[model samples]
Target: MKYPALLPFSELVNQLDQFDSIIDVRSPAEFALDHIPGAINCPVLNDLERIRVGTMYKQVNAFEAKKVGAALVAKNIALHIEEQFLQYPREWKPLIYCWRGGNRSGSMALILAKIGWPVVQLDGGYKAYRQHINTELSQLIGQFQYRVVCGTTGSGKSRLLQALHTQGAQVLDLEKLAEHRGSVLGDLPSTAQPSQKAFESAIWLTLRKFDSSKVVYIESESKKVGNLRVPDHLISCMRNSACISLQLPINLRVALLMQDYAYFISQPNELMKRLHYLTPLHGKEKIRHWQNLSEQDLLHDLVQELIEVHYDPSYLRSIERNFPQLGGMPTIHLNGIAELDFLQLAERLLAE
Candidate 1:
């Protein structure tokens, strides 16, 4: 094969494993929004430089912008070669892309090719890949049979998914992918959610790896998880699919929630701040009461009240409205929230 061969989106998807590295040459800001899975950013023009070049292109002339862009691209590529790419053997193959199959990626591909490394440049670049994902997700989401796990808050839906996954079941834990537990207090301390595009990319990648003939277990999530919106087609498919209702005793549910949200207990002030978001719905007085529970270290009482007052009602309403099929679904009742309990439940589910 010729060095620096240009491959279209179709070929690039099939031949992904052939490349040693997937390098994204767009600005870091653009890369952060979304890139091909496993692709590393090695921007030819960084965020600020990209802005400067784009401003020049609009304010000055194409010729002038190209001159400045060329210089910036050349310098950045040189630095990357020195700092990052110097250790690669001659056999190292890389797939490179930019916003479009344009100069930024082209310049890097040309340099790497000149150095005798095999390179594949993605034609139509990240834009084409994005389009491919959109098309694939639209079609692929409907191919598999989804088993939506329905439960009230603190009912161990996510834990059930984890257990199912351990038992070799296909499970799409959207909350895990989104890094949020899908509630007002769902935010994880010291962890941030991925961008919407990144979240969708994660969903796309996971779906691509599944066997379409097998049933995929998933949680009954809303259209949004944390700040990220689940793709419309995926959410739609899940809503229309079969459901498995998960239930635990209220005591167990509270214990599970307390375990899952231990960070809040340790940091009562943060818990108070999160409870404040409920003010509009519960009124300031009710929210203040919950906050007082947090301050008084009445976490068990607080969790139980939150479940009864906020989560259960909201979840029941959402599930009833969104998942009509849940009217006659199989319900799995658990006595305890132990690992062995979930594992046994997962085995029974799979056996059925």
Candidate 2:
């Protein structure tokens, strides 16, 4: 059968609600790295099969590789039909794509059309959708006004961002999206961060939904959040945007760090390993001192020392240099890290 009708990525994004599902027919690894935001993986060739087919094409010939790949694609498509598409009505519609406007998506799209469902292949496939996101993001990010949340470590900035989001204030929580806290000890316990492409996709998905006229609150972060980078345009906008500097008592900040990082206290060995990353900056002697404190269960004193000697100095330098607008930025001081303190702070921020 001839290949199915092709829909441009731009048009597909607008009419996304009409489709029952957006199916990605690429290998699992490709989909894992990135794909359309709402698209589900329905690989015509799984990862192992793809590697086998590529090796065959390289060592043997195209015809022999196609022969093996065709059988695998047919079985996978039949399984998808039986397991996934069985409940869909005859008139159901789905948009399909692969890495490029190619045979993989074409094969499944043709079969779905024959089964009496409307299926359209993405014209340039995932590549086109990715390009669209990159292009659209530059414009979308520029349209919004931003209020950057800035503070030293353990000043309750992230918690305040969460409260603001819960209170219906517009917020872009970069750390939540990156799954990292933007610091040396930022990595979550066992969770792995997303691929750079997937991270960009998450940012693009969020940017499209925000109302441009309203102020979007975000935390001040370095160019890179863990391994993934904040989009260049977003970083630039945030650095130039207005700032809200949060302040808390040093003792309270130390207590907040203990609560936030309670896991480190329970796992002394892990805490020791994470502290080693600071050796280059603070010297072996200082790092050893911190390690000894962790081993002796002296987290309160250790946290206070780190805050005063490490985090605060770095934060001050970064904010002053990167965010020029913050030179005379308004400050919000908090007496405690309790829920009530943040709630009142959120209300005040909203009023300003």
Candidate 3:
């Protein structure tokens, strides 16, 4: 019986530097939560069969376990190969992996290789890949000099991050996924928020793009923002990051908020709709007070006040609670407005 060469996880990652497709043959539920960068889900066994086979293997011998398990694996791969992998060129080289690079991945690799498609089996499988990834991430996140932009409501952290990106600086915009601004009005500006698993996956993907040797600008945030909570992996990274506070005048912040939140101007109904999210923190009376104000700017002002009172304090408390003092957090004061545009801010930061 001829079998393909089994690759060590480190070698697989190095190969990932060259190959486009690295597949995880685990159940969708497992793959959905966390997966190797760019790997797609093509399960050899669904959740139920996986559980059944594990139970059988524990109770009986390998012969009986293989009897039932082999059938399911063969059927699943046949269906997937016909539907998914059959389109590949005969020369296509794809690496396959499972939990241990054990029976499941071995079976798939041998079949694919016999069909004349080049196959690589990840030795020790997805577990090895995950161990490598987690270790690498922990080291990279700590080693990098991260710049956290801290500010009050409407202080333009998101815009500043965008501006930094335009200027060719590395920046991570957490609000982009949370779809909320981390304040009472946080939910007002967007409708699409990813699940917690998706949120970490996105963050991990973005961080993986840049060189860990340099600085990446990110917004200061609490642990839980919107419906998605920041994963412990990211929380650990942010805890030790170098932070800089972006201070702007409340009036300017209010103006910028109105501008950034132009969608709010279009939907007056949203003013009340999103206001409900903060009802638990702030009662209806304070909300109505802002509503009663004649000027929209006054309403914006009230919104800012509500943020400083409720959101900012909580954020700062978390900061204090998490780290008594953030080491190497250099403070850059933005008292008067910046003379340079977003591009210029990026230039200045990159030069720093």
Candidate 4:
């Protein structure tokens, strides 16, 4: 029997509820890199199996490789049927996809169809969805109004964004999406950032949910946030957007950093290692001094020096060079880093 009909990715996205679930049939590694949102991985061939089959195909021929792959695929399908799909009612419908509308998804769709349950394969598969995201992201970014929160490091802009988000204001928390604070030492300890494509997918998901008529509060970020590069069009739009400068006392900023980087207080060695990235920029003497401060538990002093010497100067140069609109922007002076202060600041920014 013929497999279920192919549904274009565009159509599937619009009528997402038509299917009870979306299943990704790519290898685990491929899904780990990125997959359609809400799709569960039901890989027909696992990572090692895929690699083995691919090597066989290259060394032998397509027929020989398929002979081996077909048995594995059949075994996996039986497992999926018993373990995953047995609970489904006869009326259950699922959307299936693989790389480029290929055989893996087709095989699953075909079996489900033969079993008298309706299913559909995504036309052009994951590739089409990615292309759609690439196109839609550019268009969607242009539709919204952005209010850039401009500040030097540790000015509580991220905290303020969180406050804004909590209060029902539209916010694009890039740092949250990127999983990095957008600095040399931005990488969170023991955390790996998403792949660039995965990062874009996350941004696309977030941007699509925002209403175009309302303002989107976003932090002022450099082009590259840790390992991921912000899309070119987004960087252009953000730089051209209106800005709200956040000004806070250095002491308050230091307090904020101490809290934010509190993990480093216990892990002095890790903190010093991160600081080593600055050796070339700050020179050995300055680096050694900062390391000494960290080792001696003089965190407050270390943070103050880093801010005054490093982050402040870099922030000034970046805003002046990239965000020309920030020159005469209205400044919001923050007196405290208390929870109440942040809530009030968010309310005030929204009111403005």
Candidate 5:
């Protein structure tokens, strides 16, 4: 409401939508690791400039570093205002933040306020928001009723989650958030996974939007999804939650696997390289046999063998050890891999 205001993280979280823009002034590297969900990066000191200033501060003196940093910050701010903020009207309101509530964001907020636009500076900045996420995640995880979807390899657990989401069910697709499929060959060929902090931020944002009274459908995942580790409390809650066991016939499972991993068929060399990771557990001889199968274009046979030998055994052991309630859980059997089948199963689960 004022020309320029300072808000702590507690108040800032609630009033986020009040501002037209949320600006992050941290270095690019810091912002990439994690930032407020919808905030835009407008780094006052970029990666190289930030490193240079730090070196000056350590090797030279505070006065020297401040002088150099001030000039760089001022120049960057001028360019940003000219390039980005030139068109804003008098009524435009923005929230600004940096790594800490220090010089960078303060400089931008001061300039914007001087231009007669209402501005808010985050009190403790990104560090404070990170702390809020950590604290809130532990508490928020227990509030919802989680329905964990359990199945063997290639049983279409992720597909079921997608279907439930289409039916307006609250679904937390952790694999999607992590940009992985949760297996040895889970790496997506098109995109890389998010950093651990970014993954946690995604989880926190998704959890915040859910209604505690409704059931949240989620997949049964191990501690790690590809390279990112699911938060400890959240994983523990999922393990303890009610279970939904999805079962597909072996032929359908193999068919689904082949469809999902069709890229491996054309890129047999890449598939062989990945299969080599299993050498330690399955032995070099067994892994070489699988690799040979891939080289020969016997994908269906390779997929079936991998499921029976590698994924199924590991999945069963992990599920039995982690989810003790699986023995008497409700099982949903799928006779086909059609979209209609998933939709029907989703409707049945939701109706219950």
Candidate 6:
């Protein structure tokens, strides 16, 4: 009278906060493209085997697939368990999932259970987790207090957000959202951004962790940053929300941007399109100097030219239009030493 230890996805999620290991048994490829925030991949079928079995199942029949797949699964399971999961303590509770919590994850868990490891397979697998996360996300965006950060390009906006986060502020980096760094030179060295819907979902999930009655600090962003668009309601909240402005000197702004964006120095042509956003401000010569820079000498020259011609003017315009002398308190400015001051400032603002 042996049966699988079955559990619903909701119960699994409720149990998720307690489990140390959330193991995905649904092939490495499936795990890589996107996965639950902290889940680890230990597939019972590698990508090639999964594809082979899938083709056999579709092109022939389930019997053919099952016959061939069983041997492959058994081999992979032995390799994965021996090389990977065996190191965990016996008390370690692992949540296992496959494409549908069918044979793949169930078989792995059964084997683990025999080894005296406590393992439970997700009832409906990753699709269930995706649904659960989305449901949580949809509920969050409406209720959170979004205090958006409004500033121009090269404003040290993301750095300030990170510093504020270090001081225990609830902050969201939208550049991290679109996976594009929100500029022409924004592509990461070796990472692809998430799908648009998933990006929104992650932002919503992060925001939900904060107190709704209090503010959630986020960077100012347009509706579109590369391929991702901020959800309309959330964007509206950001635009209308009362915000704190962080103003830095043009030299400091340019220097911070140069340091943060290593790719621009390495790939000068990649930054040409950003010049269009600046052309209305800097005229064409500054843009041309930027265009000409490839070596360290030209890059340094372009950096200086950009501050005088582009970033400074943009910063001033944004400040004048959005945050021009608020009624209650003057906007705070802390030069090179002032970022720490904002932690106290953020706490005080939250207290109000």
Residue 269, model 1, lDDT? 81
Prediction 5 TM-score vs. true: 0.97
lDDT of 1 by residue, 285-320 (tens): 999888888888889999999999999999889988
Can you write out model 3's per-residue Cα lDDT over 1-352, one digit (the tens) per residue? 2347687877665467565468789988778666776788888999999888888889987789888999999999999899988789987878888887478888888899899877888899878866776667555555567677776666667777888887777877888866677665567454656666566656766777788777788887777787788766667777676676666777777667667667766766776666656667678887666565523556576657755666567766776776545534655545434435545665777787
In order, candidate lDDTs are 0.91, 0.90, 0.72, 0.89, 0.91, 0.71
Report the candidate with higher TM-score, 2 versus 3. 2
RMSD of each: 1.2, 1.8, 4.9, 1.7, 1.2, 4.0
Question: Per-residue lDDT of 150-214 in model 5, one digit per residue for the tens?
Answer: 99989999999999999999999999999999999998887899999999999998988899999
User: Residue by residue across 1-352, what tens digits does model 4's lDDT show?
Assistant: 2459787888777777667989999999999999987789999999999999999999999999998989888888889999999999988988999999478888888898889788888999899999999888899888888989999998989999999999999899999999998887777978899989889998988888788889999999998999899989889889999998999999999999989888888788888889999998999999999998888888899999999999999899989999887878898899999988999989887887
lDDT head-to-head 4 vs 5, winner:
5
lDDT of 2 at 323: 90
Q: Which stretches of candidate 5 lie over 4 Å from their true place?
A: none
lDDT, model 4, position 306: 96
Error of 1 at 203 (Å): 0.9
The TM-score obtained by model 4 is 0.96
Instruction: Provide the TM-score for each candidate, comma-separated.
Output: 0.97, 0.96, 0.74, 0.96, 0.97, 0.81
Query: What is candidate 2's lDDT per residue for 1-352, written digit by digit as tens?
Result: 2436787888778787788899999999999888888889999999999999999999999999999999999999999999999999977888999988578999999999888787889998888998998789889899999999998999999999988988899889999999998888888888889888888888888877888889999999999999888999999999889998999999999999989888887778888898999999999999999998888888899999999999999988888889978769888889989988898899878987
* lDDT, candidate 3, at 135: 69
